[model samples]
Target: MGDAHVDSEVRFEVQGRLGVIVLDRPRVINALSHEMVNRIHAQLVAWADDDAIERVALTGAGERGLCAGGDVVVLYEDATSGDGSETASFLADEYRLDAYIARYPKPYVSLMDGIVLGGGVGLSAHAAHRLVTERSRVGMPETQIGFVTDVGGTWLLGRAPGELGVHAGLTGTLLGPGEAIALGFADVLVPSQRLPELLERLETEDVASVLGALAEAAPDAPLLDERPWIDAVYDADDIAVILERLDELDSDAARDAATALRGRSPSALAVTLRAIRIARGFERLEDALAQEYRVCRRLHAAPDFAEGVRAQVVDKDKTPRWHPATVAELDPAWLDGVFEVGDDELRFDIGPGTSGIITGEHDDGDEGARE
Candidate 1:
């Protein structure tokens, strides 16, 4: 309704009754920084009470994507060069923002146009209306950096049909628009060419009416057809058992999945499996976020996280010599402390409203964006 306020990396504009947020750091694929998280949360809090704003929409600048994820290089530096308190604080704020998005009172629309992964998924997937295009490539690829999926990812992935969550979580598989919608990460399939029109119409028209006019049928999701083999191979909680089953299965997808899992940090894979399983029982997205926070704190202190980040991000080397080397070598007892509630447990204090907004102070540290 007034002049646009561009906060360096994140830009906000009120167009008529619609509030638009544009993640503006195209160089980093609009990766979320600590400052960006705080700014977004504060804006959401303000708009939750603004009568003029009937709906909110989130998108990204450039053609790359909405967000690549949280800036992991900063996280790498925090883990390797400093005490991990900064990383912990950043995650706490990030998670709080994600939880807020899940329960936002107004209609929250996300344009999942391009490479949405990790923190990107957290931002968009939890929205009330998640729109994906043919170019959309989404997933939670945290295991690649020896980190378990957070931002309420386990809650969404755990509820995915028949071990598909387990397969995707363990392999860090990227899903196309079709697979994303089929897996419940997205809703309508709108062409990239029509996104601008859709946005303009959303400013004045009802969300469902605008979508019904613009949405198209998504392409066939091949992953949905592979459920039999995927469910058979990934049905077990034990990574070793899953791997053995994969080797015994005849499907090439299963073999590829096993190979992918083998290359990941064994501890991360184990803990990810545990987190997803435990998340299946949780009723709230905040519960999964809290659990992930505990696991994340433990991961920040572990050696594999640093090594994984170094190999993947710092050194550009694909090889990471994990602590245990393989799933069989990982001691089952070692994962116990990772899920335990600690003194720094994440809390979502309900604010004085029906909007379910979290009221608290957040760390405003600006970490650079990560993919």
Candidate 2:
């Protein structure tokens, strides 16, 4: 099932009772495209209904790990294309797929082996069985790209224990398997060497048995000790306040965190803080994604996403000329405008004859109150 222009980058096949999804884009570390999202979503739906398929296992093609993220270069093109409708469509579809993975009934196992981030997190974090190997490095690095964590990043990151989510959201820090597990972003940690054997055994064995047998003991999370520091510095609701707090601390970690925020797009930092704060209240993952959709609808038009992409990806220059220059100069209303949208929202089609879930409210029209 390839898209019109290209062969299928995603390989979906059945091996005995196991339904497997192999992301086959080693060139870009398997960064997801809109076509990949649709194909993967369709396959998931097909496998979900197939009684012969007992479980699902997803992994990347090469050693680079699952996925780097979404194709932001394409996103940048579409977002700034003057007609951002395509970008919006892509976000809605991507989020729908993410929500589906969140609620997927069967054993949805994601092998997060290496360099998993942004879109990568969306694909694997919500699954029932999120498997990571020692080589895995995962995070939501959207802040650097002039975007908040879309693909239900708000829901996934917001729910992490304490203010760890805040630290991750603002800084775009990459975490190892141990750190990921400590942050609740990953489940079992399997050794990189054992992954091949584990996959072989998985074809014939139950997911639980295979994981239980091969899952390696995770090392001590270096960040776990920094929880108090993270909670202290990231406690503020405002990014400015958080930065001020970080600057006040004398520790090198605090200095590093502050420097990291200084380098990101100021607009993205503000929008990300607000998104995560509001997301903390949503009960359903769909609700959080909907809010993210509202932000994304207007996000592309902002000067930062394009400029950020140009400096980081297109031009090879590390300097991004972010509008307003600093967080204090950024208008609150601009960030507010990102969240304002009409009826155009994300809708999740679970299956045939099954209705899609609209964002913001349930069919009964009552909002699922956030916790």
Candidate 3:
């Protein structure tokens, strides 16, 4: 009923009772550009008022479905020429939408399929039901792109159990469905081949039926099965320790991860680790997002973000001249500066509202006693 006729990067459909939103930029692995964010917000608002749209189930087009994240080239261009206002503006709007999704009414179902990374994780992680498939290859590789995982990732990852949060924070390594679900980043694991049939069933079933079928869906990856790497390196309290361990390991994956870290902007990595650590005990999704916003604003002004992005994306060269030799060489004062507010901010005086529970509400702010 509302502006569904116009064209956009996203497509909206009603499969019986379920309102399906598909991310359609298959050219970029369905990456979420700024225009896509606005389209998503508009459709969500439209769906909120439409009585026919009983529930929303979101996914991407093509066989490799779901989303990756914001196009970095767009962000880099926006941040060019000492005018980062556009990029900052994009972060503010995107973060607000993320907080909204985390606190939305009705059932929010996300098919966490395909390359669900940076911006993609922002969309799915906050939903009422998170369904990962064999295709899901999830991570927040913002550090590599000279960006930190904003959009409430710091808060969400902070709330993740143990040092795994910090592990994801620093290295920006992606995880498979098995690893992601084991770490509680995803809720259910379904085979990719069966997802279409399940979505069809969900279009007509009651909420109970939808969830039961999802629960009954076979887990394509067994997360709880032994994953030796996460427990070893990810278990560290800080990035320094994690890097030290990574340096020690002689395995190809370990060496690759360490080499990748060496190539990233050292300042970005340092700030990212601190952001995740400080994100502990955030009371609401907004609070966590506020902190992330602060870091994003300061990140570009620092040395690493631009250098990292230029080396990786713009220069078409794999080499980045990271300032520090290792995580240890990162200056303490510079690292602390990210959390400081020197005017710019993303915040609100939002009143208490009940949305569905996320992975965070499982605790009673008892992270300290356990950690």
Candidate 4:
């Protein structure tokens, strides 16, 4: 085993042929910072070129989870005090990292052990080998913070079977391993107790062989049973209509979903709905990321982004006063602007063994407990 490169928040090391990265901030559930993102990106780029490192694996420290999400508290401060430039830079770099992960050449394995949400999903879900444990609780809970899902969430969600992605995004529901795999966010379920052995085997064996031997059959996903209602209710692009359909269906799950959507930022819900629809038509993950970047850039200037974070994180009030309190009050023109491509857009250097590049010469640029 090689000596670890230890950042305060993240750590990297090489063990035999496996390069291991650990999210080390267990106190905050390993919430990611901009520095953490950059460090991980740089390390991944380096490891991609290292012939000695045949595979890379990511894990979070502590018992709670791999990552809770991004450090939204910092974002709240930046959005309120700065000119949105700082937030824009963070998004740019974060999205670029996500694009790179999606295109990584070497086997990238994510141990989706516990609470993986928002940016956590970005890190793990895009990997070539995504291993979820029975303890895994995965989701794109961006709507809870008055933010539309990013970090390639729209791409993942857009490609989900039926309307599972739409329901998950709009409601910000946390999914168990079964639901996560059923929704296509995860690949296999490995028992939590067996993870150590699995990692040990990775030091000598290929990812496919180790995972194939240790992976267990996932538990039943109740969400799968609800697909008929989920597809029926969330099939439309309009949030208002979806809510109406949820109410009209009159099932417990449908009503519950409706209640969940009602509490989130109206603008976030609307934008998420549209983003997923558009992402469904995209040919590549990069395209969805570029679209999400546009929507997220616009969202930084919106009142709900700050307000939602205030209520959810700063105050713990759980009552955000959305600028447009209702979906009906949302301005169609403003929504259009949210998806419009601006001077700064996210672009990737598309090819094997390449990382993403941000284009348009703009300024540089979380998850659940805090997504």
Best by TM-score: 4
Q: What 10-residue stretch in candidate 2 is worst by lDDT?
A: 362-371
Give the winner by lDDT: 3 or 4: 4
Candidate 1 — what's its lDDT?
A: 0.86
Residue 164 of model 4: what lDDT?
A: 91
How do the residues 1-371 of candidate 3 rate in per-residue lDDT, one tens digit apiece?
22233255788777776777788888877888888887777777666667776777788987765887877777776666658887787777787677767655556788898888888888888777788887778888888866687777788778765666666666786778766776667777777777877778777676557556655444444323323774687665556777788888878767877777676667777777777767777677777787888888788666666777788879978677777757778778877777887666666533223221222322222110000
Better of 1 and 4 by TM-score: 4
lDDT of 1 by residue, 235-310 (tens): 8989998889988987778778888998999999999999999999987787888899999989889989999989
User: After superposing candidate 2, which stretches have Cα over 4 Å from the reference?
Assistant: 1-6, 349-371
Sorted on TM-score, highest at the top, how do the candidates line up?
4, 1, 2, 3
> Could you tally the backbone clashes for each prediction?
3, 2, 0, 10
Q: Tell me the tens digit of each residue's lDDT in model 2 across 82-170.
A: 58877887888888788778777677888999899888898998888888888889888877878788878888778888888878888
Each candidate's TM vs. the true structure?
A: 0.94, 0.92, 0.85, 0.95
Candidate 4 residues 1-371, lDDT tens each?
66689979999988888899999999988998999999999999898788898888999999999999899998899889988887888887888888788777788889999999899999989887888998999988889889999998998998889999999999999999999999899989999999889888898899878988999988999899999888888888799899888889867888888889889999999999999999999877778888888898788788999999999899999989988999999999999988877777777665555656654432211010100
Mark the regions of model 4 whose C-alpha exceeds 4 Å error after superposition: 359-371
Clashing pairs in 4: 69-366, 69-367, 70-366, 70-367, 89-364, 89-365, 90-365, 366-371, 367-371, 368-371
Off by over 4 Å in 1: 351-371
Show the lowest summed lDDT stretch of 10 residues, model 3.
362-371
Worst 10-residue lDDT window, candidate 1:
362-371
